[model samples]
Target: MEIAEILDFTVPLSSITLERVVLAILVAIIGWIVVKVLTSTFTTALSRASNLPGLVVEFLARFFSVLLYVILALIVLAALGVDISSMVLGLSAVIGLILGFGLQDSINNLAAGVWLAAFRPIDKDEFVEVKGISGKVVSVGILATELLKPDNTYITIPNSLVWGNPVINSSRMETRRVEVKVGVAYDSDLDTAIRVATDLAAAHEKVLPSPKPAVVVTELGDSSVVLALRAWTKTSDVGGVQGDLNRGILRAFREAGIEIPFPQLDVHLTGAE
Candidate 1:
């Protein structure tokens, strides 16, 4: 056989089309497997490192694995004579324009989600008060926040809203003030009333001793003198302790022969002012 004839005839017989197809398939499968294995390994290491939830680590692993596989697929397609870079740039521009026009709010929410996940301004199961809404965080999803309120109501706050405003966490402080005011007759001794209110506040089980409870004379009303009792308690126990202390103070004052004054108006029977 002549060299020229052999070269020309065998090239067509090699079946380059099927070879390319099989190679592409093999690349995709192998790339997927490598991505998953590598991601799993990293997840396992991170899971063992701290007290984070296993599901969180696993979720992060799968998410990153998908990202890695996308990059790998782009590279593979480029090697296979596809115009990957230009296509990716064009797609990105189109996506950007679409997001700017119709999906701005959704994109803002997604960006907020990423920021929250990375920075951890709040965590799962934490009791948080944001924008006058107070609740325990049930879940921090990719697009929205799920909150379980104390009254058993479910609240779904968008991630953008969560990140956009300033959050005040009443439960975040070490100690909180449990405050109440009581009115007593003008005839009652101010010093005795202060003593009684202070003693009552101090006797509560949840009240802290270091700061010490105090009674402040706030207002002199027509019917009574208002005494304010300010006591400190652990942030978590504020609500319960407040209720208990208020009830106890009232009962204690009653036992001490203190009169709880009510509003009274002396009727002057004059025709007109």
Candidate 2:
């Protein structure tokens, strides 16, 4: 009924009493407030970090949340007059054992995850060729990396593999060169063939102006003369430009009477028929 009476109360530390109950309630309230503040602070900080990957940010926020709550729980237990040092040591030992043997792959993945998040070699929705696999990145997760292939196939590669392999980001550059190689019959005018290719490349809307597409005589094959037509275009327009140029070259060559050569053989009966 009185403040003095509440303070003067006496009971075993292990046993619940009015004073202990009141202290425990206060401890719980304060711990809850601390948890809320810590969780919010950590989440806000992580969200504002521009360099961290999305998944890593989320993982770190959640990890800190779990870790903070665990700390608060230990504080609450201490307030209840329970010693937690031994418990902590024992828990640490168990975790160490688990990590040392049973969870090696998980640890490797976690390490790789950190590297992926930090370096950011590849990003979501970008086309990449890594470890002989080509696809658009879907998500880079803590344990695995996901990719969506051109055919709509989904691939899940472990983070360790993703990080270890060389990554080629096709979309990273603004422009890419598209090369079209064609061969003409030996009898066809090489100058005429080169003019047609260079003209088509220069006239294409998607091809870049500064590079100035070039037609080079690459080789003299047994059946035909090979010409290499190389042009630069925006990365996004590469496929379209390649297809259009192929079709256009075929039509142009036909109209110009420049024969696109095919292999043929003439055999004469000398000793046997």
Candidate 3:
């Protein structure tokens, strides 16, 4: 009930002197500063010295920071004249209990993160589709993966989900194929349409020259003949190349008098009932 009685009951004030308490506080402050500086330096050195992926470097930096803080806690406890051996045992028991009861998902995320870092399926700044969400990978953290969508939205996916799902990495390959499908009227000259499409693709600056561009008759629908124009370009230029090819083909088709057909339904009236 009394303040002194409460203090005595809560902490062993008789055994710990004012000087020891002050020393512990100072040690904690100094250790925290040292830990921060050491962590930053280690992160910089590791990033510059090793050729590890950015996600792996980030994960290592975070793990090192946590390890430093743990050591700092032990040092502070030692300065306070606390028995660290027993404290460590007690802490281990507490951690075990937490893992067994409340941290199963957290543990899985951590393991998944480690696997993601080790295997390098996806990395920072790469465009990927995971679990039906498509975006550029911003970071792979201990618990989750962050992505930046095209609309500038930020999304966080649990590492467990990311690891469990198939990751479609668009930026992994250097070259990508761009295909544009166009339908021409049945009366249109198929050879001329194909040549026009191929020419448009070949004229695009981003399109690769080695494989060359080609046009193939994909399908003969009820109303039109579908032609597919396929070209190879650098992965980064795929969108631009596709757009350019589409626009160029449309314009060239008009100049060449090729008519692109639209869906139409034919109906006949029954005179006799």
Highest TM-score among the candidates is held by which one? 3
- Whichever of 1 and 3 has more lDDT, that candidate is 3
Q: What does candidate 1's lDDT look like per residue over 1-273, in tens digits?
A: 765454334225443344455556778888888887888788888889867654345446655776898888886675454688798999899999998899888878868877766666767777898889999877766677788999999999988999999876665568899889899998988888889889888877889997999999899988999888999999889999889877988898999889998799999787876
What are the per-residue Cα lDDT tens digits for candidate 2 across 1-273? 798687557665546456666787798899889888988888788778666666567656656777788888888777766669888899899999998889888888878977887777887678998898899988776678889999999999888988888899998789999999999999999999999999999999999997999999889888889998999999999999999999999999999999997977778878865
> By lDDT, who's the top model here?
3
TM-score of each: 0.69, 0.70, 0.88
Global local distance difference test of model 1? 0.79
Q: lDDT for each of the candidates?
A: 0.79, 0.84, 0.89
In candidate 1 the C-alpha lDDT for residue 41 amounts to 86
lDDT value for model 3: 0.89
| Candidate 1 lDDT for residue 183 | 92
**Per-residue lDDT over 127-181 for candidate 3, one digit per residue giving the tens place of the 0 to 100 score:** 9999889999999988899999999999999999999989999999999999999
Sort by lDDT, top down from the best: 3, 2, 1
Error of 1 at 63 (Å): 6.1
Model 3 ranges off by over 4 Å? 1-16, 267-272
* TM-score of candidate 3 on Cα atoms, chains taken together: 0.88
